[model samples]
Target: MRDGPAPGASAPTQTDMDLDLAPSPPRVEDLIAARRAKRQAILAKYSNGTSSTSTPVASQSSQAPLPALLIAEQSITRANSVAMSVDGTPAPEKYSQGERRASMSNSPPPLSAQDTAGDIGADLDKLDAADNLAFELAKGDEQDGMQAPDQETISKLEGGHDQISAADYDPSRDRREDEHKRLLGEVPHKPKVEDVMEIEEIEDVEEEDVDDMFAVAMGEPSKKTKKVKKTVSKPAPVLITTTALLDTAADAEGYYSVILGEQIDGGRYQVVSSLGKGMFANVVRGLVLQSPPEAEGILGAEVGKEVAIKIVRSQESMYRAGLKEAQILQKIRQADPDDKKHLVRLERTFEHRGHLCLVFESMSMNLRDVVKRFGKDVGLNISAVRTYAHQLFLALSLLKKLNIMHADIKPDNILVNERKNLLKLCDLGSASDASENDITPYLVSRFYRAPEIILGVPYDPALDIWSVGCTLYELYTGKILFPGRSNNQMLLLMMELKGRFNTKMIKKAKFQDAYFDEMGGFESVERDKVTGADVIRKIHLAKPTRDLRARLMPPTSVKMNDNEAKLLTSFIDLLDKCLALDPSRRITPREALSHPFIRG
Candidate 1:
């Protein structure tokens, strides 16, 4: 120092001290030796279990002093006998990070020779006691199975006053246990209603379906729900009557009844009686168990009321046919604002046991029943015909506008409401979209079949007019106008009434050869020549020359006045236009509606 600082004077600045006592930079070997020494010192301290810091790594400066600690703990132990001599014990073992973590896990404490005899003896006694207790519990289980526990044994148990034998216990124990279980769960495990069903299966039921079902069963009022039941995981089961189970089989005639008092549509409807049967469906009279709000005041307010349920045959083809009929009926409702005025109302549609079921307003009877009720031979009065004809025309007009055809326009398919004196065109299963050039020849009942269909000619809705003429003739004369037993017979009957089909009409017929020759005349039949054996022969037949007026007008008890007779003539004239042999000359539905017979 140039001039040492005086005692008790200010300390030297950090920069001044660094410059005055600064040594030469250490060699690489010395630097490494210093670092190793520091690491060894830290390892010794930590391995000795004497470090304040719990972490394995500590300060470098603290470890730099003990370089021997880096050689090996065992070598250091041999070098530093003083450390062992002081304690007469080796330093605690050093552990790596992985070893340390492993040692912290739940492993049993290791046995040591240092364990006292008394501690070992105590552990043995504890094991023996556990073994004895387990054996006694097993004995008790066997004894319990063999015989009921005595009262003395029950009273001897802990809290004996509170315990009771099962024989002496109250029946209310089950109720208490169930309530306790229910309280512990999110929802009651047992069904709240004994009759609860899968929610998905009974979609028509309201959200409060359970409540309503219970209410009805208990003879209480129903509760309404505003919210719709869209999804449910474990909805309550619904109660249904078992009346229909036994009578669900078809009889010899393939007609079966949906038993009276049987519930359907989740108990919304109850079967009252069998209505009738069709080729592909069964009609039943049903009473609505509960009125739906949407259906109220529509179709004579049929909700919670009586209706006709047509359950189609379970076969896929029949079911699909029924669905088509339902679709057509729905289309009619959508197309016409005054649908209910002329067409039979389709109240609802649903599936029941794989069959398509259609619900419709219950009608008193059909036109066939009316014809049967009024002696067919004597025929119904002209007034009755006019009343029904007007409503039928309204229906036909609607169909014409939609370009749809009632392929099977028969008396059985026409329903009448006797109460209102109204007629509804029903059974649209045979109805189809009309096509001018694609008309199907297989159409209508034999008695009401148009001549064009019989001759296999492409026809339009004018075919329906021909059906109306036949229907009216039957209604007026109480006899089928063309009561032909077979197709050829029917054609012959038509020929007698309206003469033969023209050359062009015959040419267009696909099955022309079936009924006619190349000359556009009736094909000759095969007859027996010799040995009474049948032989093919081209036999000639006479052309038809029947009197329409004399055949249609027969003696009837229902007398007619001058005005009535005039109306009758107009009626016959309408039939003439409708029953024309040529489709082009046939009366249209629209034109028929304006005829004096229909309007009058």
Candidate 2:
């Protein structure tokens, strides 16, 4: 009688809404499981590679050593500043700026941390003691020179393109390992342009970098007028207003998608030089047909044009997630009305093969190459410093207010439009949002990391000021502020230059224990935990602050004349605050931007 229960009677149910249902159709379950599997595969494909995801953990007791000196020489290329002359011909360049001569001011060399350099007397001893005791002990015997490596081991090392087997280990090896590495993947793969002796088309190129790089750099009135060429077509009509364009594209989270490389406008475009390559993509210089072809998504206005193409290197469809980011960025054109002056404008975006191509207004050159080639032009002089620093400050001020930090600010990231006397920041690959939660980034290039970032402390936009300081230093002094060998090496240099940080700043960092233990090395260790304010202690960097005082050396000013052993000093001053370990106490971008040295 209960089996059929009353037809319309309510069925008894468990209090908490317990219920039972008929088994699902196997086909439906299979379809759902298949969809889920597909979704998981897509997710796995878009995930970031292990390359930079984890915080680097070093063993406390280990002292691994760097491979033998793999120093690569810089190439001296005389590429044209203007892609084409007004008459529609490729422009030719001659000398680069640093190769030019300049008058300088003289000052006694500041007290150096090391008394000796070239001789490698105490320095080599220190380098020997620094780390990698195993390599050091074997490489330098009592006489200081290690024995030559045997040929069999060399053959073993060179013969295999893969990892060296354990048996190949021989303390007897000297130059063999280095030669093997050089033969493998190291630079100097291409020699310095000067080493070529003779160039194919250009005649009698110089060995050293010259003061005036482009033909127009020479003071004499050139018979030829600067021809503004109109070869590259105007960028697409889409508008973008951010002072920074690529910030939205770079992922701080461990998420990455492959770039799909599709030929823009079918095969009508021809590939040229390579701009750069990332693990996931290849940025190449390309020329597209100016005329329209019967194609979909081809913006009629940009039918024939030259542009930089960034194509993802992977073959998987999951790269669509990364392309989605590019697509979103491509449509963006809005910028704060007031901040437009500081923002770089986006021209057009088109899709090819699944990959997206973004077009931007071409620039003459980045500040790094300029400084490498034309630093003398910026001068060790006060007026030149004012002009260059002023422009940089203007750019920083505008960028800071937008809550966008140029995380990868470096000489290489700054682009100069010589004709306009304007500087635009480029390379958003490492840029990040200000509101992001995971703040400790190893993202900035090796040489430009701020002290806080280096120490694994929570970082903010102030890191940019540190880079600006580094840039300012390089601009005036023609030297790198912290050309460290590794992340630890960089922090060591900062500690050596600016002293140790106090407790609070130390506490905020990811690895405070190791750093805290080392604080005893400083002169003033009161035995208290380091605070944010204590980042800079009594130990100070070599200085001639404010006016030239003893020698009238001012921040950002060239102190001595060339005949007097020229010195650029003010930049050294910025390094003090720029290197300050506390984020709260560190100079803000606006404050650094308004500093007298950068002010005209």
- Highest-lDDT candidate: 1
lDDT of each: 0.55, 0.41
Least accurate stretch of 10 residues (summed lDDT) in model 2? Answer: 67-76
At residue 255, candidate 2 shows an lDDT of 20
Q: How many Å off is the CA of 236 in candidate 1?
A: 55
- For candidate 2, give the lDDT of residue 316: 38
Which runs of model 1 end up more than 4 angstroms from their true locations?
Answer: 1-257, 292-304, 436-441, 524-544, 554-561
What are the per-residue Cα lDDT tens digits for candidate 1 across 1-600? Answer: 233333554665543232212121233335436644543443333343322322334454355323323223333233333222111254232345454333222211221112212232333344333322211101122122212123344234313322221112222333223223322332212222333322222123334435321222323324322211121224234322122222335443233446779888777788999976665567999988776566666545455668899987655455576888899899887865444336888877876655578888888787766666643343455656666666676677678777888877767778866322467888887677776344433456666778777666777777788887777766665556665544566776677557667778878876677676554545322223443432222212234455556444433443546675677678789889988989899877657766788656
For candidate 1, the clash count comes to 12
> Against the true structure, candidate 2 has what lDDT?
0.41
Cα deviation of 328, candidate 1, in Å:
0.7
Q: Which stretches of candidate 2 lie over 4 Å from their true place?
A: 1-263, 267-270, 278-280, 291-305, 315-333, 336-343, 376-385, 418-420, 439-441, 518-572
As a whole number from 0 to 100, the lDDT of residue 118 in candidate 2 is 19
Give the backbone clash total of model 2.
43
Per-candidate clashes, comma-separated: 12, 43
